[model samples]
Target: MPEAYATSAVASGATGFAPTGGVQPILSVKHIEKIYGTKDSVTHALAGVSFDVAPGEFVGIMGPSGSGKTTLLNCVATIDTVTSGHILIGGRDITNLRTRELARFRRDELGFIFQDSNLLDTLNGFENISLALSIKGAPANQIAAKVHAIAETLGVSDVLKKYPYQMSGGQKQRIAAARAMAAEPKLVLADEPTGALDSRSATVMLEAMEMMNVQFGATIMMVTHDSYAASFAKRILFIKDGTVFNEIRKGDTSRKDFFSRIMEVVSFLGGDASDAR
Candidate 1:
């Protein structure tokens, strides 16, 4: 890859870390817990949550409603502070980082894709991505070229100049995916990226994320209620009522087989069978 491209990837405010020898984890969370209020009236959003993601791993977090998947994502994303426990990115302890440092850590180390596109309504697709680079202080001359390159990789170059509203639901989500991967974050956190799309669109988005993981060595942690979407991940960690219920790995399993396995695990977790379809 060209230095110009690499610099842009680094600037994208998300990370797909470059090859580090079988070295260290890109992100780690341990014994994390979050309580919404004081002890008596507390709502435990996360209870002793723990996980580690290696470089280039694709992971999914699945659960029924109110399962704390989103809460877990928020804590690791550095958007919410944990009441207890620790989080580290690139082996740097982030749980204790000051506000400004945590902001920088989030910008330099993590990437996010929420259920909503979260693109600026007025900006074109390219601008939405470029804005992330801009916040990271990337030079202006390199922004357009890098955004174009990432958009091409995500198959959204045709809509580069179109505003978010001008695109279809699938198109918007693709653009959002491009933005998430644009910064080449060491880890990408996606919360229900396919939740709002039709099946065809969701498949397209999942395939794009899988390509990023396989080709760019992008590490990903996604939260979803969809078994089909979870099938794209190498492993799935199931959560229930603010605690981890179980986990399953895909290994050499085919997507169909993986989907069935995921459904079985979901059933074991007492998730509704109807939702699997």
Candidate 2:
């Protein structure tokens, strides 16, 4: 709708575009392709998918089952490899990195939150969050303040002393989010972050994610099937048949308006209500 990189590069039918708006994109997916199997069993999990996420932006990826949303996430997360094209994070071409370099790159530049909390039962909230900062080689003395600061922002400060089992579902997820952002990684990959929560808990989790993006300047890329969850993002990229189908922004619009547009796109994509919710 606007500039190709800042506003609607997807509308221009472009790929691998670097933003010209002073600030460079934090994550660039350059016509990445992921093909599974071979010969007669070939499955193109991703076909020339490309997008740029600017710094401090919250982006959502939505697609129906078998539409390659998860596959795209995995490829960006470096949990899976792409068959073609390149991926760059903070301008580093991760696709060309060696195995050891890839490990270090993932550790230093990436953060992840899954559908489940995935926190260790043995670790308290403070410890869990601290572990991430520690892995990034944060000074031991600064770790506590970082953990507390992020926890406070995400509304998980009250549970920092408690174990995962001792907190509510929403609290645990918030803590997981805090852990992901504790290192202040260049990009955070969230996969179905609110999937395990009930309606109320999901609302709280989404609010926490919003706070993480707005208050702490975290760059987040979330993959969610729920339109309600997708609405929380600053922009939504709809994928169909392994390609970006459409893109919309929440620019100068209320969340309700954004959600309405997302629903319309979902309907047009023939998304299953049971799965998208």
TM-scores for every predicted model: 0.88, 0.92
lDDT of each: 0.81, 0.86
Location of the lowest summed lDDT over 10 successive residues in candidate 2: 1-10
Q: For model 1, state the Cα shift of residue 34 in Å.
A: 1.4
What is the Cα-based lDDT of residue 87 in candidate 1?
Answer: 85
Model 1 poorest 10 in a row by lDDT: 10-19
RMSD of each: 9.8, 3.5
TM-score of 1: 0.88
Compared with the true structure, what per-residue lDDT tens digits does model 2 show for residues 1-277? 2232243445444555333366888998989889989798988888898889999989999888989999999999988899999988999888888899989998888888899999999999999999988888999999988888888888888999999989999899999999998888999999999989998899999998898899889999999989999999998887878888677788899888878878877776778532333
Question: What stretches of model 1 exceed 4 Å from their correct place?
Answer: 1-23, 272-277
lDDT (10s digit) by residue, model 1, range 36-118? 98758989888777767788889998888887888888888888889999988888888889998888887877888888988
Whole-model lDDT, model 1? 0.81
